[model samples]
Target: MRILQKYLKGGISSHRYKQYIICSLLALFMVGGVCGEYFTNCSSLQPGQYLCTEVNIDPRTQQPRGCTKEGWAKVLCTSAPGIICTETNNGTFEREIPCKYTNGYSYETALLLSVFLGMFGVDRIYLGYYAVGLAKFCTLGFLFLGQLIDIILIATQTVGPADGSHYVISYYGAGIEVIRMDNMTYRMPQEDWGVVGRGIKEL
Candidate 1:
């Protein structure tokens, strides 16, 4: 009887700890996920925040060598030909925005994903949107009126349906894949959908 009681008590303790284990896991995920989003959101050093906006600072003066004040502006970005704006405030540091320029995927793939896998909301998930994925799944697409917004969003990088920071769809996924806008090929990876080595031109 004593031995059986000891085993029973240990099992009970384990069961009690199981709930704590689950709760700890949930807490860790919440903290890690929140920290990830907060740091990444404010990390953007881009100026003007729009493709049409002019550089917030004068490039020559933007650096400490010349003028651009710390609170004033950090970097000069002209949605001009290149993707340059980087650095927060008037600091001398900057990092180029990835996927800001064309990277790779394809209009056709996004169209196909929307047309075929849309009902599953896999299309939105593939676009790096989890909440949208849940929402579309919930309405059974009775909310497809949202499709109009989606279409325009897939049409151009500039057309942000939701907060761009929320949807970091990898270049290898949906969105524009090597778009040949205005005779000039975009600066995106020249590969087919998710294919490995073959370049679009060679293939």
Candidate 2:
């Protein structure tokens, strides 16, 4: 308010006043962009979708302490007791049974980078492949052939982060569905041991 009053009172030059307005507008735009991205990426999780809120090591026991939407929950689909808890690259436990995890890597960002700056290997570098990124940069994406291949791979999600982490994508976006295996889903052979042995001998 004081700065604006000073500018209005002719204490500041008109040119400098215009510069201040432009800078303030630019700052506001940048802040808005950041907030929009945060809402879209971090806070848009759907109901029943688990997000790993935090993970840490217990000082006394040295055991991994993982907290998800369920609060200190380590396993998903506990009634089925199928998928066990697994640690992700981002120091969080994999909260979903199908192994959906986000290591701060965005599928859209990767695809866009591959489509636009792939020749410069920006996508590869962003995916954590420094060596391959350097090679692609030096060879100009292998004369653009590698770039094409990478674009397709990233589009289909065949290639992901170099640390073996999955990309963060929209909930309804393209993804691989893995069926969970549990006691009900799997059973031991019902055949008698003697009969199986006889059959094996005949074979």
Candidate 3:
């Protein structure tokens, strides 16, 4: 009974730690102006280098007309009338990311994808479980029973990426601080893998 109690306590502690870590990261991102959700639209475009789309608003008709520029530019437009330029992140070009950060496989994303693709083992494969993922794929998510179990595990953060690295969700062209444990020690499962982007420079 004591052993079980200790195990439960450890598990709770670990979960809380991870939750706290995520919260702290979000807070830091917000304070540093590197928050990703805020950068999705034109209004929240950070004042840095970006590939902008030239948007011209007709003052008389209030209609928008513009063309995508083929190059990067410094955004200097506010919410004014007439012609204005907006930053584009259409994935065609790589612009400077103001504050690049890393994010793990979000519970919400995993949950949503699990509903549609879990039965076919696509979600497991996405999370990097190769052998078991292949098994589930072959067995149709173990005839759906395995999918149910995986859904629960993912929701509870019990099953993490098989590579032990978190997913990089908010990546700028530059480097930022990597995620660390509560003790300020790096938790990278492997070298040159856990941090965000192709070549992560730890800060």
Candidate 4:
């Protein structure tokens, strides 16, 4: 309290006061950055719980489609039909594969930040693109053109977290549907391989 009073009362030199303020702001920024990295609570989900990967939106109504009216689509784990599987707490059978992990980054947050602060490069910095952030900052978001481009990219989810993590959006929110490919969904064409081998033998 005494030190703060001294600074406030102008007991410290102006140069020292400015330095102190700058240092304080920098410290706060660093702490905020660290806290922001872990803003999501996806880790709290249990084994039986599921995460919504995508929400399909209707073109005409601009609302979510399928599943519940709130767009709560239950993710199902699939495997070979005959394979034994343990029933989850939700009364559904799921394979051993775990749900996708999230790193606390949010799609809505990124898009909003890009729309509002892209000119200052805050969006790129928040997404962990230090180099691009610095460039944007120096160029004023490339004279604002880069800012506009970033807005589109973020809205479409073309740019994501630096660690290659997916954005954590609300299950009820509108999002583009993504088809997930798994071992059961994909298989090598044995007939095609056999035909190629026969052709090689004839040659």
The predictions' CA RMSDs to the true structure, in order, are: 24.6, 27.7, 26.9, 30.4
Candidate 4 residues lying further than 4 Å off, grouped into runs, are: 1-94, 97-99, 177-203
How accurate locally, in lDDT, is each candidate?
A: 0.47, 0.66, 0.54, 0.65
lDDT of 4 by residue, 31-88 (tens): 6664222222232335444434344543433333333323343344432222223343
Q: Comparing candidate 2 with candidate 4, which one achieves the higher TM-score? A: 4
Question: TM-scores of the models, in the given order?
Answer: 0.28, 0.43, 0.32, 0.43
Off by over 4 Å in 3: 1-104, 167-203
Find the candidate with the highest lDDT and give its number: 2
Model 3, position 15: C-alpha lDDT score: 64
Q: Sort every candidate by TM-score, greatest first.
A: 4, 2, 3, 1
Task: Indicate whether candidate 3 or candidate 4 has the larger TM-score.
Answer: 4
- lDDT (Cα, 0-100) at 190 in candidate 1: 70
lDDT by residue (tens digit), candidate 2, 94-130? 3432234456688889999999999999999999998
Kindly report which residue stretches of model 1 are placed more than 4 angstroms away from their true locations once superposed: 1-105, 158-203
